[model samples]
Target chain A: MKREQGAARGLAQRMGIPGPMGGAHMELNGNREAVVEGCGGILEYSEESVRVRTGKLAVRFVGRGLRIKCLAADSLVVEGFFTGIEFLW
Target chain B: MLAGLARWLLGSVTFSVFPQGGRRGAGERFFSLAARSGASLWGVRRRGEAFSASVRAGQYAGLRAPARRAGVRLRVSRRNGLPFWLRACRRRKGLVAGGALAAALLLWMPSCIWSVNVAGVSGPQAQELLAQAELLGLFPGVPRGDIDPDLLQQSLMRRYPDAGWISVNTRGSVATITLSERVETPPVKESGRYYNVKAARAGQVVSIHATEGEAAVSPGDAVAEGQLLISGVWEDVYGASHLSHAAGEVLARTQRTAEAEVPLRQTIREPTGETVERRSLRVFSLQFPLTAVPAPQEGYSCTARVETLSFGGVSLPVSLYIERWEGFQEREVVLTEEEAAAQAWREIQAQTDAWEGVELLRAEERAAVQGGVYRLQVQYTGLENIAVESEIFTGGGDEMTGDSNVG
Candidate 1:
C-alpha cells in the first residue's frame, strides 16, 4: 500500500497534480517558521539543527536557534531563524 | 499556542533520563517509541549526559519501558496542570477542609442580621417600638432571610395604635425601622354648662378683655379673692335670664407674700477622700465581678461606669462594668443670721418666679432672728392676668329650658 502511494505521488509529481504524501507539504514563512505535514518522526533535534522523517526522504533544517515548536503524530513545526533546508533519501 | 494550552490542560509530566552508555541514540529511541505509541512529546532538551522531555501525564507510564530498553534511568523532574493539584489536595486533607469551612462562613455571615436600628423615633416610644419589634422576631442575630419587610410593617402598625405610619427597611445585615406617631386631639366641651370667669386673687383690676361674658367690674375696681370678675348670666329684654360660658382675660395688680426660714445650724455631707474601685464583666442582665471587693453600705457613695457595644440601636449582651466607692461623712455647719436670711430670701424669690406672665412691680423683704433660725417675709406686687374659669352647677333640669339657677 505504501508503494502504491509512492507510485501515485511520483505520477502526480510528473503530472504536476497534488496528492497525499506529495513530499510533505513544506511551508517556510517569514524565515522564522517551518511547518511540515505528513511527517513520520524526529530523527534529530537541537538548538541549531533539526532532522524530521517523511515517507520517502529525511528533511534536515539547518539554522540558528532552531527548536521544535510543536511535534504531533503526523506534523512537525520548527521555529527559528531558518537559513536552509536539505532533503536526504 | 492552542496545542500547548491543550497539552497543559490535559496535564503533563517532564522527566530527565541519564543514559548508561553515553550512546548518542538514547534520546532518539525514546522519541521513536513515543511517536509509535501515539504520545506526542515536545520541549525536549539535553544537558550533558541527561535528556529531558515533556509527555502527557497519562503517557508517562508508557515511557518507563522505552527508558529501560534504551538503558536509561528515568526521573520525573516536574509535574504541572490541574490533576496534580487535586492529587496534592488529597494528600493534605486538612487544607481542603479549611478551604471548605472558609467558603461556608463567607456565605452564611451575611444571611443573619447582626444589628437592628430604630429610626424616626425616640424617648419612651422608641423603647415601646423596640419591644414591639422583639415580639415580631425582628431583632439582632435573627436570620435576615426570615424577615419580610411588608409583613413586619403591617405587624408593627397593628401593634402600635398610636403610630400613624410605619416602614421597615433592610440593607445587608442592618435593619432600620422608620415610623411616625399619631397625634392626639382634645375633646370638645359642651356649651350647655354655665361657666363663670372669677378672680383668683384680691387685686385692683387694671384691664379686662371679656370674650363671652358681661363685665362685672370696670378697670381700677378693687376686687377680693373668689370674687366673680365676669358674669356668665345675662337678662334679656323680656326680663328672662340666660346663662353662658364666660371666657376672657383679666389683668390685675396683685400682692403676693411668701415667707421662708433657714436654720443657723445645718447638716451636710462631706467626702472623706477614701475610695475603692471594682470592675466586672456585664453580659446581658448578668454581671460577673472581676474583683472580690465588697460593696460599701451607708456612709459610702457608689458610682458606676459601664462600657457597652451597641449595634444599630440594639445594645449587645457584652459590657464592662466599673464600680467606684467614695467615702463620705456628715458634718454640722453654723451660719450667721444675715447669711440665713439671705438664703431664705433666695428660696422665696425662686418660688415667685414660677408664676407665668407675672411682671414684678415692687418687692419688700423683712428679716428677723427667731429661735435659732432666721425668718424672712417677702411681699411681692405683680401685674398679671388672674382670671379663672369655673363651671356653674344648676338643679336637674333640661338644658333647653335655660334654667337660671346657678349654684
Candidate 2:
C-alpha cells in the first residue's frame, strides 16, 4: 500500500495535480472559522484542540472554545478563536 | 440559520456517546465511525468523559451499529424538531380537534352577511328600506348565495316608486344598499271641469289675467275670502251660454297677520343627575337584554349606542346595545321680559316663513305684556297670487235665463 501511494503521488506531481495524501484542503475565514475538506475522520476532540486524519496526514487545530460546527463524511467545519494549525505525517 | 431550519424540518436529536467498559478513545472512534457512515452531525462538544452531538433524527438510529463497533453506548439527551412536536400533540387530542373546528368556523362565517348598511338616506326611509329588504330575503345573517343582487334591486325599486336609483353590493359579511329618491311633479287638474277662480285670502284685486274665464272683479276691487275673482260661466257670440274651467293668475295686495305669545313663567322638565344604564345583545334578528333592570316607561330620556363586532374588516352580526336613561323632573323657570320677547319673535318669524310666495310691501309689529304673558303681533301688506280653483255646481241646469248669460 505504501509503494502504490508513492507511485500515485509521483504521477500526481508530474500532472501538476494535488495528490490525495498531500494534506487536507483547508479554508480559514479570519480567525473565527475553518472548513477542512478530504476529512477521513476525527482522531481527537476537546475544548482546546481538535485532530482530524486526512489520508496519510493528521491535521490538528488548537484554539479556545473550539467546536465542530458541522461534521460530514468528507468535510467538517470548526468554529472558534483559531490560534494555530499543524500537519503531522 | 438555513441549515438549522433544515435540520428542524427534517427532525434532529441530540445524543451523548459514552465509552463502554471504561475504554479510552471510544468517543473519538464513535464519531469517526458515524462520519464514515455518511451521517451528518453538528455542535460536537465534550463534557468530561462523554461527547454530545446533534444528528438528523433519521440518521440517529443508523448510528447504533457504528456506536456498537466503536465500543460506545449512545444515549439520547434531547429531541428538537417537527416530529417531536407532533408526537407530543398526539397525547392531547382535544386541542387538535378544537383548532380544526376554529379554522372551519373562520372559513364559513364570511359566507353569511352580518351587517346591513343603508346609505344615501336615513331615518324612517332607511328603516322602511331595511324592512323591505328583509322581507325580500336580503337581511343580515342571510347567506350570500341566497341573495340575488339584481332581484333585490328590482324589488326595492318596485316598492319605492319615488326611488330614482338603487344599488346593492355585498362584500364579505357586509351588505351595502345605496339609493336616491326621485323628484315628483305635481298633478295637473283637468280642463273639462267647470271651475271658478275665487279669492283664497281677503285682499284688494291688483290685477287679473283670465285665460279661460270672464273677469268677475276688476282692478282696485276689494274682495273677501272665498269671493269669486273669475267666473267659469260666460256667453258665447251666438246667444248661448257655456260653462268652462277658469285658468288665471290674480295678483292681489293682501294683509297678513301672525301672532305669538310667551308666558313669563313656564313649567319645564329638567334633567336630574340620576341615570340608569342597560345593555342588550343583538344576534341577527334576536335580541336579549343582558341587564336585569326594567326600562323606565315615562319621564326618562334614553340614548342608545350600538357596537358591532368585526373580524378582519368583516362586520359580524353580533351587536351590543347600551342604553343610558336620564331622569327628568318638573321645574318652573322664570323668563325675563327680553327673553320672552325674543322667543315670541322667533315663533312669529317661523309662522311668516311658512307663508310661501308672498312679497312683503309694508310691515308693522305690536308687542304687549299682559297677564304674565308676552304677546307679539305682526301685520304686513303683501302681493301674492290669490286665485284658487273652486268647483262650480250648476244644480244640473244646462241653460241660463238671464240676459247677462246671453251676453
Candidate 3:
C-alpha cells in the first residue's frame, strides 16, 4: 500500500496536480490565526492547544489563547498567538 | 471583518451545548458530527461541560441531530441580525410606512428649487429682471434639473439689452442671478456753442478769474443767486457777433444764518439697574411666544432684533426674535444760566459747520431765557467760490449775444 501511494503521488506530481496527497493543508496568517483545509475532524480542543485528524496524520496546534474560531465541513479556523504546528503520522 | 459582515448579512444564530449521557469525548464527537453534516460554526467557546457557538440560521435546525447523536443537548439562546429585524418589521406596518415616507421626502426635497436670489441689482430694474426670469421658466418650485444655467444667461442678455453683463449660478436648491446695468456717458457740447457762467449762490464776489469768454464782474463784486458772472458772447471790431461757452471762477463772501435753543430745566432718565430679556421663535409665518415673565410696569426701554436663518446665501422664513428691556426712572434736571447758554451756542455751531459752500469765518450769537427755555440765534459769514455752468439758448440763430456785468 505504501509503494502504491508513493507511485500515485509521483504520478500526480508528473501530471501537475496540486495537493494531491489527500491530506490537510495549513495556511498561517501573520502567526495570529491559521486556517486548515481538508481536515477530517476534531480530536481534542483546549484553550492552549487544538488537535485535529487529517487524512494519514494528526495535526496539533500549540499556542496561547487558542480557540477554534470557525469550523466547517472541509475547513477549520484557529485564532491565537501560535507557538508551533506539528504533525504526528 | 468581511467574514463577520457576511455572517451578519446571512443571519446567524448562537446556541449553547450541554454534554450529557456520560459519553466520552462528547464535545469532540459533536464537532465531528457537525463537520460531517457540512454545517459552519464560529465564535466557539467552551467552559467545563458546556460549549457555545454560532451558526448560520439555515443550518441551525440540522445542528440538532448532530448534537443529539454526540450526547449533547443544544439550546438556541440568542437570535440576531438583519433577518430577525425584517421579521419583526413585517409585524409592525405603521413603522415601515413611516420610514418609507421619510426616505421619500429626503430624496425629493433637494430636487425642487426652493428660492430664487437676485444679486448685483435692485429697484425697478431688478423686478423687471426677475419677471423676465419667471417668463423663461426659472422660478421657485421649478425642478432644478429642468433649468439650464447657460441657457438662462443667454436669454437674460437677449431680453434686457441694457444689461452690460449677466450670469446665472445655481447652488443646491437656490438660483442666483448676477448682472450689471449699462453705464451711459453724457455727450460733450462743441465749444462754439454759447454758455453763461452764472453765480451758483448769493455771495459778494471777492475775485474774478476768466480763462475763456469775457468777465461779467470785477473784484469785490456782489452777485445774486443765478446771476451771470461771465459773458459767452463777444463782438469783433466790425460789429460781427461771436459765440462760445464761458468758463471762469468767481470767489465771494457768503453769509449763512443758523439758530438753536435749549431748556434751562430738563427731564432726564436714570437707570434703575434692572433689565429683562425675552426671546421667541418664528417658523414660517407662525409666531410662538417663549418667555414666561410678565411685563414690567416701571418705565423701561425695549430693543428688539430679529435674526433669520440663512442657508446657501438665501434667508429662510424661520427666525429668532429677541427683545431686551432696560428700566429707568425719570428725574428733573435744572441747568445754570451759563450752562444753558453754552448748550444753545454749541447746537447752533454744529448747524453752521454743516452749511454748504461756506466756512465759519465769524459768528454772532444772541440768547435769552423765557419760560425755562433759552431762545438762541446765530449768523455765520464766510468766503466761498460762486461759479456755476448754465447753457446759453441759441434761439435758432448762428450768432448770439450775452449780457455782461450782471453782478
lDDT of 2 by residue, B1-407 (tens): 89889998889999998889989888988998899899999999888889999999999999999999999999999999999988888997998788889999899878888798888897777878988999999887788999999999999998887788999998877898999877677957675557788889999999999998898999999999888888888888997768888879999999999999999999999899879999999998679999999999888999887787877655578889899999999999999999999999899889989999999899899999999999988998999999998876554457433323212
Q: Considering the true interface contacts (CA pairs under 8 Å between chains A and B), give the fraction that model 3 also has.
A: 0.69
Best by lDDT: 2
For each candidate, report what fraction of the true interface contacts it reproduces: 0.40, 0.84, 0.69
lDDT of 1 by residue, A24-73 (tens): 77788988998898887778877777888887888899988877765666
TM-score of chain A of each: 0.79, 0.76, 0.79
- Give the C-alpha miss distance for residue B89 in model 2, angstroms: 2.6
lDDT (Cα) of model 1: 0.81
Write the number of the candidate with greater lDDT, choosing between 2 and 3: 2
Error of 3 at B47 (Å): 1.9
Report lDDT (CA) for all predictions.
0.81, 0.87, 0.82
| Each prediction's DockQ against the real complex | 0.33, 0.59, 0.53
Residue B38: error of model 2 in Å? 3.3
- Against the true chain A, what TM-score does chain A of candidate 2 give? 0.76
Candidate rank order under DockQ: 2, 3, 1
Instruction: Determine the C-alpha RMSD for candidate 2 after optimal superposition of all C-alphas.
Output: 11.8
